[model samples]
Target: MTDETQIMEINKPISKTVVAIKRIDYVDIAKGIGIVLVVMGHNDFALISPFAHKLIYSFHMPMFFFMSGMFFKPDLPFLMYARHRFNRVLKPFLFMILFIYFASISFSNVGIPQASRRLIKALYGNGHYLDWVQLWFLPHLFVVSLFAYFFFQAVYRRGLFPLRWVILSVLFIGGVLGITLFWPFEPDILGRGFTVFGLPFSLDLVFVSGFFSSWGMS
Candidate 1:
């Protein structure tokens, strides 16, 4: 063998330390813009153009959902994972539900009727247990993340690396397209509305897109 071939073979087994430095200034800027849009949307400000509103709605919540998934590493034990998820997701969800209910009461005076309907649905186990308009995404995300966690665990146990990611991508994309195609084009039904298949113009599609995007980022 030549000298170069000898050297290459000798060095082939050593691991390389490759550090990746991310330039996330654009991400930060986008997040800032998203926060502004969210505030304006909530306050009924006319500053947001209709096109901007549509664009923001398309990706803002999805971006936030992907951000939420970024911190979830799978190295922890199952019990620890459960605890962490509960604290991070469930606790905040409960708090938001209560807070929004009160806010609706104070600001709109339609709280009692809305809350009553939500409570009835919760009791009957139909629709989401919580009915806060801006807060529905939280519960949806929590559930989706939990499902993803378990799915990751199962794939990890099987010693699949890149193949698992491929499977996840296919499922996520297929789900998004399927839901978007079949989604109902109507407003949610009172108290009984639930759409896991991207009803009301592909809401779950965006969330699933965010979930898949999170995995792609890592």
Candidate 2:
């Protein structure tokens, strides 16, 4: 072989090494800690004081979102990325909801009509409308992940990586204000007063969750 071919062969391993990603131990440790905090936040244990519970609630979710963003890869085509997320996040969400709803109708005291009504409402994916309230986070998370994907693509496309946090910060502030100040669009359902805020998968929270993810990316 010629010198150029020999040189290329010699450099192949080094190139591969440069692109290889090493496992981050600290990230795993942090994720473990975050999982514990999430469990703590969800339970009303006598061991956990009210203040501690509040503290856990305040940061645990943000921590998860941030970590998710840290690993965000926006290089994939939009449809491919969406399909991956749908399989990872949305599929499980639908499965759980369907399983629970059908189980209730088949084996529990819930009548078919009642279960059907709830199943329909569950499509809204809001916490208030859900029977398994905690599951509401999944759909919202899916939306946030997609939003982050689009957002980072825009930033990279425009060469605005440096200003990404600035843009996200502004959006975060606006989201906070909007959620706190404005009343949700409360539409009555089932002849009872049901307040639904974020329709079609908690879109209202996209900005806030996107900010946390973007922070992780930075």
Q: Which ten residues in a row have the lowest lDDT in candidate 1?
A: 121-130
> What's each prediction's clash count?
0, 0
Question: Candidate 1: where are CA atoms >4 Å away?
Answer: 1-31, 40-48, 99-114, 120-131, 180-210
Best by TM-score: 2
Cα-based TM-score, every candidate: 0.59, 0.82
The true-versus-predicted C-alpha distance at residue 76 of model 2, in Å, is 0.5
Model 1: lDDT equals: 0.61
Alpha-carbon lDDT, every model: 0.61, 0.84
Model 1 per-residue lDDT tens digits across residues 4-114: 999999989887999998768866786787788677666644464776667767766666666656656677887787777778766786676566666777888676887
Candidate that scores best on lDDT: 2
